[model samples]
Target chain A: MRVALFASCLVDLFRPNAGFATVSLLENAGCIVDVPPEQTCCGQPAYNNGDKDNARDIAKQVINEFSDYEYIIVPSSSCAGMMIKHYPQLFEDNAEWYKKATDFSAHCYDLVTFLHDILKITSVPVTYQGNITYHDSCSSLRETRVKDKTRHLLACNEKINLLELGNPEACCGFGGTFCVKYPEISESMVNDKIADIEATGADTVVSGDMGCLLNIAGRLKRLNKPIKVFHIAEVLAGMTGIAAIGDADDTKKSEPSS
Target chain B: MKSKSHAFKQQAADALVNVSLQKALLNAKDGFIVKRKKAMDELPEFERLRTKAIEIKEHTLSHLDQYLEYFEQQVIKSGGTVHWASTTTQAQQIIVELCKQANARTVTKGKSMVGEEAAINDALEAAGFEAIETDLGEYIIQLANEPPSHIIAPAIHKSKQEIADLFKDHHKKYNFNSKLETIPEIVNEAREVLREKFINADVGITGANFLVAETGSTLIVTNEGNGDLTATLPKTHIVISSIEKVVPTLEDTSVLLRLLARSATGQEITSYTTFFNGPKRNSDIDGPENFHVVLLDNGRSNMLQNENHEMLKCIHCGACLNHCPVYSAIGGHAYGWVYPGPMGSVLTPIMQGLDEAKDLPFASTFCGRCEEVCPLSIPLPKLLRQHRNHIHHDKLNTSRSRLGLALWAFVASRPALYRPLSNSFIRALGWLGKKSGRFSWLPFASAWTQSKDLPAPAAQSFMSAWTQQQAKKKSSENE
Candidate 1:
């Protein structure tokens, strides 16, 4: 299978390892992967901010960039969901573009969903021995229906222990501009999320979306927590040798679990 | 009834630090969410029923004018009068005039949200008619001289101890001087005071949960039976309902009622689901001698002309409010209006004009949980986004944020520029935060860094790393 990696702007700029792990995992699953550097964003910020004109321009740019790929897999469900669900909405007024948008959306899939549903690769040959909890991003869970597929992939890794987080579907308060716009409410919500994460006593937290991972990791770091945060792709590809998210250096051992 | 939606941010800040309010909110949250979930679980056909409810509401809204006319005709045939009001003030004036005509000195109310919308109690009081709240929650807030915070549970923000005090302070006027300690005692004390008011009041008023076009019957669902008493006890009963509340038939009302109580308080049904048509018949044992239905338009007719016509399908279930993360954090007072929560966030802006209530839409996380649990499937997040779009298109937001978004949009749309600029920016940030792996503070990120550290970006962009990997792979394959 020929696959194009849609490294969301967040993953491209902030967490490239997750993007690389995505490529590695896809290649190992017998797929040819390409990183289209022309791709910039999924236009969610503009679209969500109610800037339809700019959202349309950005959507057209993204659509044109990955239009030729047989499969467009995004590591971040937030970005993938935007492409799959909202791109068509942006072009409803323009029938010509709507056709192209729908056709393109059909080819788009979140990374884990692509691996499990389309590629039929549920389990990856990866190893991790510590207890980890999964935070289900709202877009991925509700929009893309990615709840059980991710757990199915993680469940295959016998070396890893998966702890259930409370109300995993709850928002992490990183609602694009929401965290910045209403800082107090966002702070309170994320604080509640941190308490739930702590209750599980999981050493690591994993999720499919970079936006949520960054938000949770940011809070965990500010609280000076020892918990490790990794994108699901990183663990699935056995790429935890580098520093976990929100950490400056790989000062700790490469494999803390074993 | 005056809008405090403009000061939402400040009110929300205060609510955040309020210890008593937080404790009360937590208790309400546990009770509402658990019961709702269990009730929904017990009904295997709940989703199917929700679909039917949505369809019924949609059909009714599409033909609202026809239904309203038919409903009016049926009410007239049943010897009741239907009065139309284009705005809230008009509705209030209509009710006050009717009260004056009936020579009413005191009017008892049954937890009417529309009454709150129209500021009827204040108007009636200003007009020299004592307006008494009959429902326990409404009565508590009325005595405290406050608006109903939550729609169904008006005093949800108050603690039990606070209610006990409120009763002890206010009930003394009714010769009830005993200090109420328990929940039952407080309820009984209020009931005793309200029973006399209900019996003596010349007029009674209530909000309709649904208006049956087929039978011209106004239906109200309540847990404490206050609405039923308010609808039938006095010499005259007036229903303040919006034009969209009219349904085609009683059967349609039943389908919606099945979801209403379960969604509102998680009961299979409320303690009272009463339907009364017009005034008392000759053979009737008990009912008001006079029946009146005030169909208030108040921008709903205008709302139907726009993309927001679907908003009229709401049954005022309050499920969206209970499930909303924003409402749960700040409580209803922060929304600063009669309506609060996800439903309030959409309705307040439309009803009060976007300029006055623009902040309400932006306060949510757009989590879509409200839509999931909504019985009518109101598409609350979509309506909220529409409000945001209106605000943005009209330039209602601050110029600073507007300019920032414009600049960001320009950069983001151009990949060639955005790639290099953002890539270099993050690389620089990564180097600066090398020690902490996160930044405690960053320019333009005070909102996030105020309470949380921002995760530092990687040293290289994914595009650059992928390029290097490709070159390395080509060389290895050639070798």
Candidate 2:
């Protein structure tokens, strides 16, 4: 299979490891990968912030950059969802561009969905051992329907123990620029996300999107939490020799399980 | 009086901006959203109910002609009258005619989004009938001469102080104390004033939460019992609702009710989930002598046929409103519609023209809580996108917004120009924003920079770094 890698802007700058791991995973599955040289932000930031013009402009750039790819895969479900569902709607007026957007949407798939649905990579050869909790990013879990696929991919590592985070689909307050714009409500929402993470009793938390990782990690850092936060790709990649962040103590969650 | 949509937006903006109103809206927002989420989270049958509700709406809408005919027949057979209103004008005309026919001097109304949709009170008064809104929220706003700020809550935007003031000015004829400032006090005052209208009025006008075609009944679920009073007290009971309110069966209505109140107020059920099958059946002595259910189609029949038809599944729980950040920021009034928050954003464009109501969709943060907590699971953001898509395609993006998008599209599509240009742009912007790591002002970007800071981008773009990472990852794997 000829695959095009859409390592989202966040993965490129803030968390390159998830992006790299995705390329390695896809290549291991016997696929030819192409990295389009001109990819940029998906414009979700400007788009949601009433800067539709900037959003659409960036969307056009994104569409034109990888419009010709046969199989476009991304480590993040949210970005992939932006391409899959939102792009076509964004360009619904300009028939020519709308067609390009739809075609791009067809080629685009979230990493787990691409692995599970397209490649049929149910389980991979991986090793890990710990109680792990998973946070389902809202756009992917609900928008792209990546919940079970993501879980299945994580469960591929037989040595891993997957603990279900309370309210896994609850938003983590990273609504693009919303955290900065409405800092008060955003803090309140992230506070709830942290509380859920604390309830899971997992030494590590894994999520698919880098946007969420940064948001949750920032919250964890602020609260000075000891639990490690890693991208799902990093978890699927696994650590060979050393323990991951926050591995020293398996702090038990105080609450009785419901 | 302002249009229902504008009145809501203006009042909501006032509430959202005020420290006290913001505090109250925040309280309401958190209380409703949290409880609704917990209730939804706990329900194993909730997803199934959502699907069932969708199925009910789909079936009801697809066979609307048939179900409506059956419903009309049943209403007539059960000693009631059924009126078909194709437009708001027709609806108003029929209602006015009913008031004339019955010589109704007063009308007691229940909270109704459809009534808001029709602007029926204005018409009722134009026809010389005094329409008294009986729902406490509606009554507060009715005295203030404003629209319902929230669906279900109706007067969700108003504080008790506003209600107290409204009562002091409007109901002085009864010598009601102006000092009442509590929810219970206001409710009592509204009840005391409206009780006479309910008793002495020759007719009642209420909106149906759901119309059960299977049983030929109108269903209204309210905590305040205003809907029940409005439907039963007067000699003539008139149920007015949009065509989409109809469902196929009582079982379907039950499925929706289980989700509605929980999604609405976190109640297992509303205090009064009344199903008035018909009026004055021989066994029913305490009911209205004449029962009339005026089913209004308005723009809904057209909306029912569109790709965005899924919105009609809204049970008016206001779960979407309570969870919406924009709705929280501006309150229901800013959306400038009868249905405020996420649900109203979708409906306003369709009912009103897109050009007139372009700002509603842009108000959302695309946070997705509305979809998550919705009992019927309506994808609100997606529908909002439809409104924007129309606005965008037609070049109706807001005056300043159009030029910005055009420039962005121009620059982004051509990276040879965009990369170096944006890099330089970022560099200049970084210096401009160095004082606080944020820009207080920037040409064309001031709107954003005003509310929030535009963080400086990394020295390199993601594309350049991804290329470097890719080569390194591949070689390391090969080694």
Model 1, B217-258: lDDT tens digits are 899998899888887889999999989999998888889999
Top candidate on TM-score is: 1
Instruction: Give the per-residue lDDT of model 2 (tens digit) for B144-233.
Output: 877776887777667778778888888888887668868888778878888888888888888888888867898888888888888888
Off by over 4 Å in 2: A1-4, A9-34, A41-75, A86-137, A144-258, B1-15, B168-171, B178-183, B419-444, B465-479
Task: Quote the lDDT for B177 in model 2.
Answer: 61
lDDT of 1 by residue, A159-229 (tens): 88999987776788989999899988998888888998999999999998888898999999999999999
Error of 2 at A258 (Å): 43
Q: By lDDT, who's the top model here?
A: 1
TM-score of every prediction relative to native: 0.98, 0.77
The C-alpha stretches of model 1 lying farther than 4 A from their native spots are A252-258, B475-479
